[model samples]
Target: MEEMPLKTAEELEAECLRLLHANMTTREIQRVGIVRTHADGSGPNWTYNQLYPEPTPIGKHDAHGIIASVAGKWALVA
Candidate 1:
């Protein structure tokens, strides 16, 4: 298997700041959510819906990875 590249905290912080300056809103950043599946396959699957409303269906972001780099630092915006 191929290994994933790692980034420094400072680098991540910088990227996040740049994204915010590029006109990304707090709500847009908040929409980035993670999904998890059960190992035993008996638990219910959960999802986050910001751009939509549905129990089993969740919303999506146009640029999720770019937004998530901020790591939920919505308070940083003015």
Candidate 2:
């Protein structure tokens, strides 16, 4: 199998924001968070969490900075 191309930081952040917006609006999720994982045996990976209403996995990202950016923006609105 061919290896997938890695996403840039900007792309990761945009995707995280998009997923957060979609979930918050559609699923009515009140709160969300990010968790770091090593399931891929890579250096680091991040997963979005739906903390309120229910704990659910929304999406995964590669950059922690991107995740932090999403969380900071969320704090501003939340």
Candidate 3:
């Protein structure tokens, strides 16, 4: 299935957290899909670093960085 579109940053963060927990199975295509959905195709420079602590060198960020960059900016804290 296609990735879901994310609205609030909190929702993005929650999903990122879930993916981060599955880092061992994370993939590039999946990463881009998650980030795209999280930012709603905005292509923001922000990232999701908190999720993938040791992601392999890719482009500007890892899967976690993609999620954290945007989600961290507006994610609602508990």
**Candidate 3 lDDT over residue span 1-37, tens digit each:** 3433335445655566565545554443333333232
User: lDDT per residue, candidate 1, 1-78, as tens digits?
Assistant: 332243333444455445644653332342223332222222232222232221121212434444454443322221
- Candidates in order have lDDT scores of 0.34, 0.42, 0.43
For model 2 the TM-score comes to 0.32
Off by over 4 Å in 1: 24-66, 69-78
- Against the true structure, candidate 3 reaches a TM-score of 0.32
lDDT of 3 at 75: 26
Each candidate: RMSD: 11.4, 10.8, 9.4
Residue 33 displacement (Å), model 3: 18
- What TM-score would candidate 1 get against the native? 0.32
Q: What is candidate 1's local distance difference test score?
A: 0.34
Off by over 4 Å in 3: 1-4, 24-46, 49-78
